[model samples]
Target: MSQNWKFFKESVRHFWQVGSLVQSSRYLVDSLLADVDFAESRLIVEFGAGNGCVTRELLRRMRPDARLFSFELSQVFHEEISSIAARDPRLTAVHGCAMLAAQMFAAQSVDCVVSGLPMGNFGKCAKLGVLSTVHAVLKPGGHFSQFQYSLLDYRLMKRHFPAVRLGYTPLNFPPAFVYNCVSA
Candidate 1:
């Protein structure tokens, strides 16, 4: 199945987890990753990597020696990422939760985190848990980029990161607001 079809199917069956019925547009993907300096980044983590859309772009832009660990909660999407991983040695497809990031990697070891998680659908505690995990795993000056359909999590993101920059891409299916946060 095509990536879009797979994403739509998963979103229909698991809206709370999958978040969107459509894959991210190139504009949104670019906007979300604009702040990441791929050349300087060594270890990158991607959360909620749906259908490997952003994963593919990240791989394309990253340094050859850099590593990406993509975490997906959905089995179907994880399989798709795993297939991509098979071809790219720098990619590691992890079928798990983003909250487990700290446990999977050393503290302050990740250079960047690009997340497509539907934080708008998560409860307060769950959002805090995931954000805390991102902060914990990120290096002192690491970047954390996430896209949301609304600005609901803007304040929450600011609370977690020392600095937060917002950008918007109206070309996406539902449009998206990108939050590029810098870890302290």
Candidate 2:
């Protein structure tokens, strides 16, 4: 099946969660990952692995022994990404919510977290839970990158991460705001 079709179908079925009708573009991916140091990262987590665009990029840059766990709440998206994960030993696909990150990974165990989750769509409590889980799993100096079409979650991100750097990319389907954050 064509990847684009899959994205369209999933987006129609889960618009509020998926956020877009297509996968992220290279420009948006690059912008979101501008500050990630993949060379030294060993344990990484991806919040939403919709069609594996960013997952492929992360795998390309990550070391041979590095492990990447990708979470997707939509069963369809999970199945799609799981197929991609099957081809790479370093990648693991989890069909669950990002809020379970703290339960899945030990405190300060993750080197980085790249999120495709729509934080702006989440309620305040859900937002706080997910952000807190991200903070709990990330190492003291680790990074978390999240991209959204709006700055609706800017203050929410700042509340959890001590340092937050914002970047914009107009090349995507809808211009995106990339937040590069560091855990204190």
Candidate 3:
């Protein structure tokens, strides 16, 4: 089956985890990554990397030496990204939860984190847990970029990052608000 078909099927079956019925648009992906300093980002992590859409884009923009660790909870999506990783030496496809990020990497070691996680679908504690993991793994001035269909997580992000900037991409299926946060 095609990637979109797989994504649609998975989203329908696991809306709360997958978040959207389709993969993000290029416009939305670009907006989500707009603030990343690709040149300076040597180690990057991507959460909720569905079907390697954003993963491919990240690989395209990253420096030849940069590394990306993509985490996906779904077996189907993880398999898809694993295939991409087989072709790209710089990518590591992780079949696990985003909350395990800190365990996988050293504290204050990651340069950036691009998240497509459905924070709005999670309860307050789950949200805080994931945010804390991201914060802990990120360098002092590392970037944390996330996107949500709604603005519900804006204040939550602000609480985690000292600096948070919001951007919009109306071209996506349901549109999305991108939060570019800098870890303190």
Q: What is the TM-score of each candidate against the true structure?
A: 0.98, 0.97, 0.98
Could you tell me how far off, in angstroms, the CA of residue 28 lies in candidate 1 after the best superposition?
Answer: 0.4
Give lDDT per model, in order: 0.94, 0.91, 0.94
lDDT string, candidate 1, 73-128, tens digits: 99999999999999999999999998889899999999999999999999999999
Higher-ranked by lDDT: 1 or 2: 1
Error of 1 at 61 (Å): 0.4
Query: To one decimal, what is the Cα RMSD in angstroms of model 1 from the true structure?
Result: 0.7
Kindly provide the TM-score of model 3 when superposed on the true structure, using C-alpha atoms. Answer: 0.98
What TM-score should be assigned to candidate 1? 0.98
Candidate 1 global CA lDDT score: 0.94
lDDT of 3 by residue, 1-184 (tens): 8888999999999888898999999999999899999989999999999998899999999999999999999998999999999999999999999999989999999999999998889998989898999988999999999999999989988887899999999999999999999999
- lDDT (Cα, tens digit) per residue for candidate 2, span 33-138: 8898888899999998888899999999899999999999999888888998889989999999988889999999999999998887888888888888988899
Which pairs of residues have clashing backbones in candidate 3? none
| Runs with alpha carbons beyond 4 Å of true place in candidate 2 | none
